[model samples]
Target: MRRITLWLMSTVAAVVLLFSYRTSTMGATAPDTPGVVGAAPGVVPGGPAPGPSAGSSAPPGSTVVNGTVSQTRWGPVQVRVTISGGRITDVVALQVPSGNRRDREINSNAVPALRDAVLRAQSADFDSVSGATVTSDGYRRSLQAALDAAHFGS
Candidate 1:
């Protein structure tokens, strides 16, 4: 009886502590990236902004396609691909989570690696960056969409 009562009390206390815990991001507002304006469709308000206008010139024999915006837990992620000679020549991340210092720091390291991986693989089948799984997943989703739209690697 004593052991059971103690266990029950500990469980109740654990539940209370768990419910009372608060995360730093619980009520935080994610800041937008500079020079980014107008949220894409289905993107969270104040989230990823549009990239260069459609009228922007592309290199000869190269087509630029913007992938569908992917909403991540932290913010939105979007990729733009420049395809030429039936291959992805350039991969640009138009949007990434810049909501906080941590997000910026993480992406600063993760995005470049992610871009390089896609260029080498010629697809979005690369592994996710450690400690930035959410952003990596979002990046892959957007990149795949862009590749599909461009009919790249088909």
Candidate 2:
């Protein structure tokens, strides 16, 4: 009886936490806080969609490079980096770990956060997404590859 009571209490607590979080975040109503769930400064939606641009030509004053594809448990993670004026101009996710609706949702939320962090830090050393550590690591590695290819210093 005591074990059952404890288990039931724990379940109830977990449910409460879940709903509270959902209620707080479901609407995306929070103000833009950059490097969080909101868009980063100078970032465009679907920014520079990632792709293979290695050895390919980009417009003068700007260059695009593709990162290595990182395979995660859910799927693969890949990205592209844009460089101009010796600085990182943008990041775009070409491929993400998406094998199901849950995967899609998780990646969807994580990618933006990762991008924002990368742009802000101008490096691969950014905070991992709250619920997407695997994807985050893959993204960091892939982003680093693109930066290396571009010979980016910062």
Candidate 3:
């Protein structure tokens, strides 16, 4: 019985040590190079790329949109907005860890206000969502981020 228990313990210890070493090694290596294992056959890594024409009209449409919103104890609120062609096409709740309770309220009250605001202002400076101040602020910030990216590249 003693011999069996000792053998089992030794095996478990060895396995744990091996797993730890493997995990450490895994963290040490760099991730796969950009154009190596799964890269396209002909494309070379770090190759020079073509430049856009000076006359290009801002790609003619929306290319991509992303946003992040953080939640607070006051409410589950965050904002993400997507725009194309100098217009807001979509708005998302980026950081609302909480359910849509307050979010819904904000959306209901703030969306129309926001749409009006967007239409009126040169940029995405919408009013806060009614009853959901934090969410409203987050949404506005997100919209601003998207609009800023659209207008200024930064």
Candidate 4:
């Protein structure tokens, strides 16, 4: 009985110590390469953009248009489209549900997939991530807006 108590206490202490060390070291290490992985879209080591260009206009040949900021339960979803020769050459996620870890993870995965899909389809008539329906819906909605603004199809 005494040995059992000792083992339990030791295990608890070890767990506490592990957590303590993790919490202490988490913020100590700085980002090796800023503006890379885990960096917010259009963000650098300095800071985020001054503000979101919610509904910016497009240029003549190459257009840069921001889509609607579709606000979901988690957060807002938006996209920026780059068009060249009336084709979607690039799609950048200007905003996504990033209030929590789950939101970040989901967007990190879903945004890239959506970008590729949209680029391939050449329109917003693409599928969303199966698990992340809300974010996907927002993506589609905003993508459509940007496409409309760019006058891609019409």
Best by TM-score: 1
Better of 1 and 3 by TM-score: 1
Better of 3 and 4 by TM-score: 4
Candidate 3 residues 1-154, lDDT tens each?
9999999999999998987664221221221223222211121112221121113222334433333332353333333344556555444433332333444444566656655665566455556545656555655665565555445324
The candidate with the higher lDDT, 3 or 4, is 4
**Model 2: per-residue Cα lDDT over 70-124, one tens digit each:** 7665566777787877767778776775545576788778988998998899888
The estimated TM-scores of all candidates read 0.71, 0.62, 0.42, 0.61
Cα lDDT of model 4 by residue, 8-92, tens digit: 9999999989877743213212322223223222211112222343344344556666677776656667777778786888788
**Cα RMSD to native, each candidate?**
7.6, 12.1, 13.3, 9.7
lDDT, candidates in the order shown: 0.76, 0.68, 0.44, 0.68
Candidate 1 vs 2: which has more TM-score: 1
Instruction: Tell me how far the alpha carbon of residue 124 in candidate 3 is from the true structure, in angstroms, after superposition.
Output: 2.9
Indicate the residue-level lDDT of 47 in model 2.
34
Tell me the lDDT of candidate 4: 0.68
Error of 1 at 74 (Å): 0.9
